[model samples]
Target: MRKRVLDVAEESFQARGYHASSLGDLMMAAGITGGALHHHFPTKKALAMAVIEERVAAAVEQTWIAPLLAAASAREGVRSVFEAVAAELERQGFVRGCPLNNLAHELALADPDFRIALSGIFSTWRQALADKIASDQQAGVEQGTDPQRFAALAVAAYSGAMSMAKTAQDASILRDCLAALKPV
Candidate 1:
């Protein structure tokens, strides 16, 4: 029941934004009563925080961090990720942007806890990428670049590209941005 509620809330928040997804709607979607939801999450904010910390963070790990770490090279991994996501968005025929970015835009300024949680996730993501880059540099697969700076820039570029592609309703923007990021 707790997982059901969290799943419903995550989907709702992703589709409708935090402010717009009322508790009533979430309860209905999850097929749970107020008593059940409150038993697990005392407040809506608590539920949102759980969704961010668990669902959103896990999504980033599965989609970005794990894949990048598992690949033979950071450069190849990042590029492969870009291409895969572009193909996915193209197949879906719509862009929803990054889940983490969407939540950050909606809830970061609304509460300090939300900002802290989101920032922590972003920090973890950046650090993972930086680790991969540093490994590649040490292996002589890359050179003359600061891993931290490059990781930050790559994340920022992907976030901006996703936003633009979502707005333009075009996945090609992602591919074009991938071209610009060829050096890394």
Candidate 2:
């Protein structure tokens, strides 16, 4: 029941934009009625918070962190993670863009707390990648670059590149941009 609301909310927020999406619309989409929706989420902002938390956690674990952990070593993991990001962008046909980045652009400044929450998610993700990069170098699996800066740049590049790609509706442009990245 709770998951249903979160899922519906995530999709709604993603598609409709938080400001544009109404509780009335969400209610109809979710097949949820009145006080029942309020019982689970007292306010639309609370529901947005849940959506942000869940989506960030899922993306962090599945997209960056998981790949970083699963590969033969830290370097392979980090490389695979970026590759996965590219693959995902390509798989989306360069149309979907990024879920977190999209929301941050749309709602972050308009809502201060939402911006902070989104900022935290990005920070956590970058730090996690940085740690992996450091570990890889320390473990001698790979040797090169300042892990922290590299991680930050890599994450930034992925987000910015995806946003641009989404704007152009060009997957190859994203691929070209990603290919230009080297630890610098």
Candidate 3:
């Protein structure tokens, strides 16, 4: 039941902004009663935090971290992750944008707890990319690159492209962004 509630809440929160989505909406979508809902999550914030810590973080690990670890080079790893994400957007035919970015944009300023949680996720993501880049640099796969700066740039570029893609409702923005990231 707890997992069910979280699954529904994750979808709801991603589809609708956290501030705009209420417990009533989640309960209705999950087909659960108030008692049942509260039994698992004492408050909406709690539920959102759980979704961030569990679902969103796990998705990042699976989608980005695992691929990056297996990639032969930092550049290839970043490219692969971006290409995979772009392909997924094309497959869905709808760009809902990154769930973490969505929540960060909406709640980062208003809620400290949310800001902390989201920041942690971003830090983890950046660190993973940085570590991969550093490894590649040491292996001579990536020369003349500052792993930290490159990782930050890659993450920022992807986030900006995601925002533009979502706003324009065009998946091509992602492809273009990935193209820009490609080495000469």
Candidate 4:
């Protein structure tokens, strides 16, 4: 039941802004009656927070951390993550912005907790990438690629490119951005 609620909330949260979404809609989407929803989550806001927490961790691990850990070279691993993003943009037709970033922007003004949580998640991601870059630098001495700066720039570029691609409905733009990133 918890999984169902979270899954349904994720779908709604991804499809519509959190402010525009309601408990009734979430329950309906989950195929649960009113009581069933309350049994799992007393309030829609609480459920949203849970969804944010779970989604943030999952997104971070799958999109960035995993790739960074998997490659023989941390640098190549970081590169792979960006490449994966470009591939996803192409796969999705570039119509949807990242769910996490979208939710952050929407919930920032409405919910301070949500904003804080989202910022923390992003900070973790940035730190992970920066650490990986630093690791690569220590092993290979790749000068001109300041680990912290590279990590920050890469994420900013990725998010900005994704935003633009989503706005234009052109996934190719994401690929173009990835291609422009220095091969580190």
- Compare the candidates by TM-score and give the number of the best one: 3
Query: In model 2, which runs have C-alpha deviations exceeding 4 angstroms?
Result: 73-75, 89-94, 141-144, 181-184
Winner by lDDT between candidate 2 and candidate 1: 1
Runs of candidate 1 with Cα error greater than 4 angstroms are none
Clashing residue pairs in candidate 3 are: none
Model 2 TM-score is 0.87
List TM-scores for all candidates, in order. 0.96, 0.87, 0.96, 0.91
Residue-level lDDT of model 3, residues 43-145, one tens digit each, is: 9999999999999999888988899899887788888989999999999899888888998999899899999999999999899999998898788777878
Best by lDDT: 1
- The local distance difference test score of model 4 is 0.77
Can you list the residue pairs that collide in candidate 4?
none
Give the alpha carbon lDDT tens digit for every residue of 1-184 in model 1.
9999999999888888889999999999999999999999999999999999999999989988988998888777788778889999999999888889999999899999999999999999999988998999889877887889978987887888898988898989879877876754
- Candidate 2 whole-model C-alpha lDDT, 0 to 1: 0.76
Clashes of 4: 0
Q: Model 2 over residues 90-159: C-alpha lDDT tens digits?
A: 6766466677888889988888889999999888888887887777778775476787887787778778
**Candidate numbers sorted by TM-score from highest down:** 3, 1, 4, 2
Show pairs that collide, candidate 2: none
What lDDT does each candidate get? Answer: 0.89, 0.76, 0.89, 0.77
Q: Write the per-residue lDDT of candidate 4 for residues 93-135, one digit (tens) a residue.
A: 6466777778877887787988888888878878888887777
lDDT of 2 at 171: 62
RMSD of each: 1.2, 2.4, 1.0, 1.7
